[model samples]
Target: MQSEDNLLKVLIAEPSAIIRNGLSVTLKRIPGSWIQPVEISSIENLEHVLETNKPDVLIINPNFWGYVDMTTVRAWSAASKLKIIALVSSLSSDVILKKYDESISIYDSPEDIKEKIFRLFDTSDTEKDKSSEESETLSSREKEIVVLVVKGLTNKEIAQKLFLSTHTIITHRRNIARKLEIHSTAGLTVYAIVNKLVGLDEIKDNFTL
Candidate 1:
């Protein structure tokens, strides 16, 4: 059980106003608590609300995941204390929100939803800053590759420049993704700039995603 002083804050997101209103009422009534339920009928304001209100849990429509960039989601997931619970409609939805804190079926009964929210308090682990775990300390060669990639070198081009095989360059790309947990060129551009692998002015126009 959470501390008595802690508010039972939940942000219920659903497309249907009727369904969202119903869910807010049902969730607010889960016993022995100071109920604080906020309904989000659209994802456009989600980023702002999440940053400002800082709710304890975020119960979102699974489709909401598709509306934003994974980079945005990754940044939010990295910083937010709120436990994310995706309302899954199918097995595929699970894949969409796989990195979320928890997932509950849309078809679950109110009681089940209550239980799952309560359980989040128990099962939720304190997430350290993922940069520590996700962004591995690159080897000197890896750093070279990052700099080269940021300089707009294709895998074949980089391999030839470095006197390595194309296959080696491809493996390095995969390893870089595994370490950074980011794959898009845009995301990588930001990473490279922030990490000082390359200065912002050094980035070529063609390097954009």
Candidate 2:
């Protein structure tokens, strides 16, 4: 177990409950228990949270910057180590994204979010080792499943295409989730594109599915 002093405090400032809750759920699934995430729906409450919570990381919407002065926030918390990450829900310009230490899209997978958070803090050896090990375990069949999944095929459809039982397909999906630490299809889609298993043009319309 990690000590309290070593805990990674994460403050999520998002207006949408759905997005805020989604990010909170994904962050909790990361390899370690040291992450303590707090959510707030309003940017107005951000300064108070920063003063009281003193979070190590802040995941916020880029639009919030228009309302709050980031420079003032940084000055107020200058004594502590604070990293700001943009929680992007829509297309943001390079100039806007450059203001953040890192940016995560709503479509990004749990694994991708984990990597970004880990990168920010220079995570421990145990977390890094586990991620490295999981990355190497996906079989060729799993890759095929991921491609079909990104292409917007249902489990039953994939089963029919692969000449396998739906039960077997479900089992394979469970194993894939365990191996990749990615439970959402959006994450799988991102993984497929990143690994070149599928082309963006092939799944552009169904990427959110």
Candidate 3:
């Protein structure tokens, strides 16, 4: 059994009570009591709840971004290593979807939801070991690409700087994403900062979703 301090705090922000409660119930049935979910039905209270709860993971609807931008939401939980997962119910543009660390469809099965959430945490010993191994396999070029990416450089910009073709830069980025298992620019930024590949000050003002 996991200790209390090791529990994963999850905040579910959805307007519908049924969806919020359903997600909470699904999370609870994951065998271990390591996940502790807190649900809120209003987007207006999101910032306050985020500040107070400091949850490890946030499962929120993308529509809330219309009221609160991704950068602002990230700022409120800057103290914690927060992972924002979009609780998508309707069609969202690719640009909007890429801002989040992950996405879960409303129609996803309970089992699928559990898997997606668990993979983010990677709590199992075997999974942790595999992740560690994969993390170590990043090439120096890939590391450079990751740094440029976190610095808000477009693929074309990075290609120009590195004297490489745009196609090559895109390929490198794809490989980097696969290696790190992080799909979004926001996620890549966090990884770069955490891994000391880029300093926070370098990207604080310039970083985008």
Tens digits of per-residue lDDT, candidate 2, 44-71, equal 6787788887888988888764645557
Q: What lDDT tens digits, residue by residue, belong to model 1 across residues 71-179?
A: 5643554235567777654443324655665555544456657766766565324534442343244545667888888778899999999888777677666556655
**True lDDT of residue 12, candidate 3:** 92
lDDT of 2 at 142: 71
Where does model 3 exceed 4 Å of error?
Answer: 65-67, 123-209
Alpha-carbon error at 108 in model 3, in Å? 1.5
- TM-score, structure 1 vs. true: 0.50
Model 1, residue pairs in steric clash: none
Candidate 1 lDDT trough over 10 residues, lowest sum: 127-136
> On residues 1-209, what C-alpha lDDT tens digit does candidate 3 reach at each position?
77878888889988888988988998887775478999877766777888887888899988863645778888888445688888876656657766776677665556556666666666545576774454335556678888988888899999999888787777666556655678999998898888899998999977754
Give the clashing residue pairs of candidate 2, or none: none
Candidate 2 least-lDDT 10 residues: 130-139
Ranking by TM-score: 2, 3, 1
Each model's lDDT comes to: 0.67, 0.76, 0.76
RMSD of each: 15.7, 10.6, 13.8
Question: Count of backbone clashes for each model?
Answer: 0, 0, 0
